[model samples]
Target: MRVTIFILLVFIPLTSFSALRFKEVFYFSERSNFSDSHYRNQRPPYYFPGNFAKEQRVEPKRWGEGEAELMEEALSELLSLPQLQKMFLFLARKGPVALKRFAEYPGRVPGGLGRMNQGDKKIGSVKMWAAEQPSFYVGVTDDFFKYMGHLDREKQVKVAKYIGLHELSHLYDYRMRFSFRDQQFLRATGWKWAWFLRRWENQYVPEEKRRALMKKVEEGEMSLRDLDRIVREQYGLPSFYSVTNPKETFAEVLAAYVLVPEAKDFLRPEIMDFLDGILNN
Candidate 1:
């Protein structure tokens, strides 16, 4: 029985949602779960920013100093988490094996490039770069540490840890699971679609010139409804991509699970059912 259970654990492609569900139950069972205790210990006195501009300003220099400190602290704590350590080990082994098989195909993967890097300009948010060898670079801005510090410290740390885990998952996937050839195929598909759209746009008549054509498309004049169809159509693409790729979908699900327990309540019925399936499987 023990051998069977161990084999199941090793072979199963445990979804992020499933892992989170297990974590929830495990943490609940443990008397010293850090959720409440961590928060209570780290609570800080209130101090709100005086103005909107003050809040919006980006200061990379300042953020760098704080980010470094936070990163060190977070890394230390992360290394100590047994569950996270185990997950990392599993991914380290599993990711490369998956990638090797994927690399044999001469097509772009269904999802966009699975990796990204920090560019010359420091953007506040992380960005993805599609390349022969995809990699992710965590962007740190001046407000990074300050913003994190401002969070209900205990709650925020948990959030940060979750974010780190999610990003790490991506790293593992790219290193082991994603293939350059697959990405190239997907990129070609995207280009073909872009070309089709451009041709379609150019064929519009004089009465439906650029502005008018844009307005019409914006108003969904071409589609079944005369609503803002273009934006709506574009909005759904991410959902499709999320569904097709387990890595992307899992990372997102895991991030949400770690940061927001309330998310389980708000998820779509289909998604909730999916999560249940992952957990039970």
Candidate 2:
């Protein structure tokens, strides 16, 4: 599990939503088990931003017995959260919510939280990859049973809910296509198009510092690992991983807003106001 480098909000433990009168919005049911041969010897790819090879070829595997039920429980809790329910519904309307678990590809990608496949068609819902080792990874490494061994029912649900929003928010970003359609969001997060590079660049770092940072990275004067450190130091963003880019920043901010109310104390007023306006709409 990746430890958060920017920890601005301390989570207050809350009781599971099972005790509340919760209405189910998204249903996580078992789908057809995936085999490489079923997809015709070609593994479907999952994607993320940054230089980590944009996407990875993935072979989807069926969730172990009873796993879908556990995931459903977590989804139910997610819907119970007042802050995320409307936004989730708004995003889901754009596409069907599909969840799949896959074998890890050979690489350094740690499968941090989960990934969105975004699928091939531009007009519909995309396939989503859940974490291989389940919620917290705990004592397990790619072993769901061992990960579960470390958590009782309550903690299991809590961990599931925590990751659930982050992954779902990725789907929201994909469905919305914020990069092309939402300039306000991108600008608010401090991302601007660099026509020269033909990609979006983080503007949180001052122009001079950004130029120097890139020069150092290209010349191997600075390690790429230091990139996230600089972004966090300059922007004091919600999370270290969010510093990766704007799409991730959007997801992380939404997840923090929903899961940690205290995040309001730390997030910039513009960000909080933006989230409030969008979610309420």
Clashes of 1: 12
Per-residue alpha-carbon lDDT of candidate 1 for residues 101-190, written as tens digits (9 for 90 to 100) = 010112221222121111112223332111112212233323334333333232233535555555654654465443122343223112
TM-score of candidate 2 to 2 decimals: 0.58
TM-score of each: 0.34, 0.58
The prediction achieving the highest lDDT against the true structure is: 2
Candidate with top TM-score is 2
Taking all chains together, the TM-score of candidate 1 against the true structure is 0.34
- Cα lDDT tens digits, model 2, 39-89, are 333334533223435455333455777766665665667776766756656
lDDT of each: 0.33, 0.51
* Clash pairs, model 2 backbone: none
